[model samples]
Target: MEKIVLATSQIENIAEILEPENKNIWAWIGKAKKMGLSDYALGILPKLRIHEENEMEGLWLSAEEPEYIAEILEMENNSISLGKVKILELCSHAVETLPKLKFHGEYVMERLGLEALFSEHTAEIPKIENNSIWIGKMKRLELHFYAIEILPKFRIHRENVMEELVLNADSPEHITKILEAKDKSIWIGRVRKVSPIEHAKRIKGKLDFTLITPDDQEENGGD
Candidate 1:
């Protein structure tokens, strides 16, 4: 029933400081698993540790023999440490991806601080065949599940005969919500935003369509 508090970064470091290298570490690890230390916890324990006073107590417990219980305690400590590291990594990644600015054209490149970098590129809010639409790109990863991340922000008119599809913008959750909705037609387009030409092809004929671009073109690609 000992109490231990540690920051995410401190977990793995504490584990290493406390245990360094002990071949019997696996025994403690197995016991911790039985005790219900999650996979994350087991991985990070090497870095996390108790305060100086707690360390002294831990040392005493380890030396006191009973051996098996000491092993269990060690495993538990490691498990907790590993868990913290995972939590920290996930948090860090989320923060990195969170949108900093509003997803609108008003901010332009200045909002994302990409004005100078993207100076050559123009931000066009493409008009899809169906005025109301969303889109994104699809990608697959080994460890992570497949998902779509929206590319460009665009809209389609409801009256358009051709449908417009964006790639990678929609999540399964979003699609589920759309399917459950009363107005299914209004929610037309790919779940995620993707390349304009590609999206136009997907929704072509399904609805009257056009890709909104800085340059204007006829429905049949005519001037």
Candidate 2:
């Protein structure tokens, strides 16, 4: 049995009830969580680790609503972030929040091709925000790269060859390196190009490069 005490501050409230030297803090936290006092438990936890969200809408909704996110983007503090994907979902599903977004968010949504609002608009959406950090799962290369190796977005056919920095991801040499980088941000210099491949058909234009798949380590073509 545990003794119960009442106090003002959180620490005073906890300390009055339990002696830290005699009590198992971690065990108490576990008991508190099991007893459905999670919010109360969190008041004493020293560190926090968040797991991934099971849904498109994540914890950011508690910070601010979709309207607030739209307002932040519109007003040029794109600095304050809601998840980009989550914002996209909100803009798609919650039509009420759409008008809250101004030019910048509208541009991104249109370029992402998520909504019909800009389907008829012809003006090009500009600004990739060169310094912004992008994080998302991406295919190692483009559809064109499946047929041919990497095709650099720009043709510097003969010049700037030394500037071409190639990264062979998932290679045997980098297997441990990637594993080491799992929890931390690996310093990738920049993303000069990104192409989204949403839909595709059989490549009737002949595959020049051999195709590899993870399952069975199968190969498609060689000669």
lDDT of each: 0.23, 0.23
For model 1 the TM-score comes to 0.20
Q: Count the backbone clashes (under 3 Å) in each candidate.
A: 53, 0
Give Cα distance to truth, residue 86, candidate 1, Å.
31
**Candidate 2, position 166, lDDT:** 25
Candidate 2 positional error at 203, Å: 11
Model 1 agreement with the true structure over 30-61: per-residue lDDT tens digits: 22311222222323233333221111111001
lDDT of 2 by residue, 26-133 (tens): 344322211111112222222111112211221111111232223223433223222222223122212222222221221111121112122111011212222132
Among these predicted structures, which one has the highest TM-score?
2
Q: Which ten contiguous residues of candidate 1 have the minimum total lDDT?
A: 108-117
